[model samples]
Target: MTKIPAISLRRLSKSFGDLDVLGVMDLDVGRGEFVSILGPSGCGKSTLLSILSGIEEATTGEITIHGAPLNQSGQPFAWMPQNDALLPWRTVVDNVGLGYQVAGRLSKRAARDQARLLLPAFGLEEFSRALPYQLSGGMRQRVALARTIAQGRDMLLLDEPFGALDAITRTELQLWLEQIWGVDRPTVILITHDVREAVLLSDRIYVFSDRPAQIVAEFEVPLDRPRTIEMLAGAQATQLELDLLRALHVGSGDTP
Candidate 1:
């Protein structure tokens, strides 16, 4: 028998009054798979994430998780948005544990203890007591990710988690993220506009068209896991990057 998909979307669409944000779309993300949705900026990519996270209701569609209908009664995913969104007043450990506390799943003390254990893995052990204001942008994102991981959700919804950082920092975090994802293998759905980033991190990529988005093309990355920066420079990776770029250009109605 075939294993059920981690996530399945059929005829998914979203609209706001007179504005349509997403057209009918279908997608499937396999268990423990890293899938990226690549498209131009302002192409309703984030809207899709919002719908999946239950922050926004879909205009029409069906969404299933593990072959069952999506139920929003409890948190189904660990969502990390574009900005780190760390609370400035909270220390790193407390920030990481906030979700558990808010959900009443753990006492504050227990939550912090759990978050402390995860800190070393993210290279954030030394900064456990530091406030968000004291951390660098990259460090803040790490804390944000640690917080996401602390939730222990099977699916991770990342809405351009590294989009705000500098190029160097972003690349560093991508490699770090790949290593972390390798160890735990949580199913990931990443929304991004960067072609090279998509090719480097995704097991498969779905390219979307401009506003009122629809998937225009899909590519399977076939590269080995624990992906490194060096691999991105290899001929196969380079070709995949070129192909994704071409698709993005065509999807957005621009010449490549």
Candidate 2:
């Protein structure tokens, strides 16, 4: 039996006036699969994400979710962006629960109640009262994840969610994300250029071309479950890295 994709992009194109960003791209994210869009700086990775999220409208093509059109809702599913973007005025608990607060889906107490229990799981038990400014860059992102998770979004669109953190902290959070997201795995579409990060985290990766990007290649990481940083540091990681490098070579106009 074939599982219907969580999100499908069929010949999708996007442009800003004369500048074309994405050109008739087709992408498939399977149900509960963790997929990453890997490409270069100016290749419109974020633009593609924005178009899919309906934050930026596409010039043509279709983005459908579970047989329904996302054009109707404009913004459906959950979004966790490149920046932590935690509100300065809100404390950790309030920040994590902030989405519910804005949507009026849950009262203040109830939202915080959920955030409080989930905080320690995110290594944020001690900082519930702390403001965003009081925490490190990495700590702030944990709050961001906590907030995103609080929404319990079924399809998560993550744009470099851990891009800003230090190496050690980033590794810590990566493991945390795998654990949390592993349970009740949501259909995830991540935009990242970090090859190892993409390889370590994703089930499959979609590589793109220059400017008006195309799906140059797709590679399934054969690495088994319970993955760790150590796995990425070994020979298997070396081979996977080369595979990713070759796929992304298309982004640089490297013909293979």
Candidate 3:
């Protein structure tokens, strides 16, 4: 039996006045699959995500989630942007529970209670009362992630969630995220600039072209999971990375 895709995009396009950001693009993400959109800085990756999340409208397209048209009531996706975007005045617990409160699905106290229970899993139990100003960048992102997870959505749209972090911290968080996603198996669509990050974290990767962005190539990562950074050191991984790099270079109108 074929499983219907968790999300689908057909003839999706976005424009800003005379400038086009995303050309007519078609994509699909299967249930429980980790997919990545790998592209350059301004290739409209975030724009596509915004459209999926209903933060922005597409100029022309058909978007479906779980076989239903977009905006059909219960949200099929949750979004995590490039920045942590935690509230400065809110404590860690409060920040992590804001989603539930905002949804009116739970009271603030109930939301905090839920956040408190989940904080230990995120390694944030000790800092429940800490303000955003008191936490490191990595910790703040953890709180943000906890908030996103608190929503219990089955699909996640991550726009370079670890893009702003340092190398070591990013690696640590990526491992932690992979572990969490492995357990939950939420369908994920991640937008990223790092080739290795996409290869490491995704089941399949779509490399996008320059402006008026569209998928130029796609590759499946054949490695089995519970994947670690150490696996990326092998010959196959190196060649795959080189291939992705070449695709990006070629997509940008440069000879690889």
Best by lDDT: 1
Instruction: Tally clashes: model 1.
Output: 0
CA shift of 145, model 3, Å = 0.8
TM-score, cand. 1: 0.97
Model 1 local distance difference test score = 0.91
Candidate 2 whole-model C-alpha lDDT, 0 to 1:
0.83
Question: What's the CA RMSD of model 3 in angstroms?
Answer: 1.2
Higher TM-score: candidate 1 or 2? 1
Worst 10 residues of 2 by lDDT: 71-80
Clashes found in each candidate (C-alpha, N, C closer than 3 A): 0, 0, 0
Tens-digit lDDT track for model 3 on 203-227? 9999999998989999999777988
- TM-score of every model? 0.97, 0.93, 0.97
lDDT of 2 by residue, 1-256 (tens): 3877888888889989999888788888889899988988678888887877668988998988887898675456678888888999999999998866654389899888877988988889999999999999889888887787777667788888888877888788888888887887888888888898888889999988888887888988777676787889788778988988987885678678
True-structure RMSD, every candidate: 1.3, 1.9, 1.2
lDDT of 1 by residue, 34-115 (tens): 9999999999999988988889999998999888888743667888888888999999999999866765389999999888
